[model samples]
Target: MHEDAARAFYAAVDEGAYDQLEELLTPEFVHDRPDQTLRGREAFISFMRDERPLTETRHDIEAVYVGESELAVRGTLRDADDERLLKFVDVHEGEARISAITTYTTQVASRLTEQ
Candidate 1:
């Protein structure tokens, strides 16, 4: 069930159905991005709307593991000009509503300015 929920979440994002995502997200849903963390469903929705304006977004899931109310999805994100490997951990409620999401990017960050 967790795996299915994870897949459905990604599918919704790929289809650009931001509204549908709300159904799968918990009220306290938290998304951890590379730069910051977004808390709450409203904040998450706003974040997606602002970030995902791409021509396309695709995810190729290599594996999915479910444990209790948690799901781990290992996949690759493919777009028109870039491809990124991503690993996502989703904590779900009884009804598959994602309560939290932690994502990791394969890209390495370089320091632009020395502190």
Candidate 2:
């Protein structure tokens, strides 16, 4: 169920379905990254709407790890044509809402998928 939720969240973000975000996130959800943290679902939605609006974005999920209350997915963030932009691992907590995201822009050859 968490896996499905994870996919749905990513799909919603990639497709720019901002209206659906509230249903997928806790009202007080927190998103932490290396450079910034977004606290609360409204903050996340604002970032998605104003800062990270990439309508052609897609995730090619390669691995998923599930724990009692945590879910993690490792994937390639790709363009509409499937060209890799970054390698990322998104971590979700509390009812499958994403809590953190770590992204690698520096491609380690092992992580890159040959197009």
Candidate 3:
């Protein structure tokens, strides 16, 4: 109930569970990111499933905030060896299914994780 969609999203992406991802996203889903914008669920899913640079990675969620019509999550993306790759904040908006997403990311430094 609380940040359920957001949590499901990260899980789906990390595990490459495209079926679950489709169920959680609207047909008109759009993603706006620092590097590029992906329009439509199909396009986004295609990119995630086939074209993304890093496929063997996972998101380690740090926090989630739920609002009336939006949800925001902060997390770090880690490689297969559990090395921190980057930090990201994603703001998602939708009703029953996520319709839109905006992502901000920064490369993580090895020193940050040494502690």
Candidate 4:
């Protein structure tokens, strides 16, 4: 169930289930990515719920690595058409609830920028 938190985070975002997010993340959660750094759960949730450009995308998890107090998930983000937009590794740090997430992403095309 702990490992599921990483997967659930993505599921909640893709499903736009903001309520589920609160259960998975702590109040001081932060998301650090290439494009932006979102501090606090509210800021991260706000971006996912309202500001994310590719709102209809799905995250296909390829692997899950669980550490003592951390988790790393490798996956590809795909559009509704199933086109691979980017490959990513999200490193989540915390114990019971996620406190921070650092994302690394790779893409061949700049298709996302076109959006």
Candidate 5:
């Protein structure tokens, strides 16, 4: 179930269906990345609209592992043209609705400023 939710979440991102994410994420949902942490689903949506990071993304889901309190997803982020940009593992927490997200990706981290 969580695996499906994770896939749906990524699918929403790839399709730019920002509104669709509301159903998959909790009101207090948090998105954690190497560079920043967005608290609340609204904050996350705002970031998505502002940054548009996944505009060219199409996640090639490698696997989804169900953990005690989280679902771990491994995948390669590809561009619209099917070019792999980076590999990542995202931890999704909570049941029914995703409450928290923690992403680990070295490729994206290297792009962040030291400051």
Candidate 6:
């Protein structure tokens, strides 16, 4: 269930469906970015809307560590420009909700020939 929720969250974000984000995030959800931390669902939605416009987002789950009431997904995000490794920890009550996300980006050069 936690894995499903995490996948759904990524899918919604990739699709630019900010409305669906609320369903998967906690009201007190906190997002820690390189520069700042965003609190609440509204703030998160706005942050994603204004900052990250992912042309392509993919997640490859390497492992899942389950705690008493939480699940941590270790994975990577691949786009056309770069790949980012991420560890997403979700806290669950009944349905899964993203509590925190830590990510690191890797540089990847384009392979296309210049026109």
Sort by lDDT, top down from the best: 3, 4, 5, 2, 1, 6
Better of 1 and 3 by TM-score: 3
- Candidate 4 off by > 4 Å: 108-115
lDDT of 6 by residue, 69-111 (tens): 5566666666655555344333333346776554433422232
Give the per-residue lDDT of model 1 (tens digit) for 23-98.
Answer: 9888888887675788999888876666544526577778887777676777777665555534333344444578
How would you encode candidate 5's per-residue C-alpha lDDT over 1-115 as one tens digit per residue? 3788999999888787898988899999999987789999998988776665446668888889998779899998876677777789999999899999999984772323333
**TM-score of each model, paired residue for residue:** 0.76, 0.77, 0.89, 0.91, 0.87, 0.65
Task: Write model 2 residue lDDT over 15-112, tens digit each, in one string.
Answer: 78877767888788788764467888989889877775355778788998987887788888887777777777777787556554444434533323
- Which residue segments of model 1 deviate by more than 4 Å? 53-55, 81-95, 108-115
Model 3 weakest 10-residue run by lDDT = 106-115
In model 3, pairs of residues that clash are: none
Worst 10 residues of 6 by lDDT: 106-115
lDDT of 5 at 53: 45
Selected candidate, larger lDDT, 3 vs 4: 3
Candidate 6: regions farther than 4 A off: 53-55, 81-96, 99-115
Against the reference, the lDDT scores of all candidates come to 0.68, 0.72, 0.87, 0.86, 0.82, 0.61
What would the C-alpha RMSD of candidate 1 be, to one decimal place? 4.5
Worst 10 residues of 2 by lDDT: 106-115
Q: Whole-model lDDT for model 2 versus the true structure?
A: 0.72
**Residue-by-residue lDDT tens digits, candidate 3, 5-115:** 899999999999999999999999999987678999999999999887778888999999888999889999888889888899999999989999998889544532342
- Per-residue error at 25 for model 1, in Å? 0.3
Cα misplacement distance, residue 2 of candidate 6 (Å)? 2.4
Which has the higher TM-score value, candidate number 2 or candidate number 5?
5
lDDT of residue 31 for candidate 3: 98
C-alpha RMSD in Å of predicted model 5 compared with the true structure: 2.7
Q: Can you list the residue pairs that collide in candidate 1?
A: none
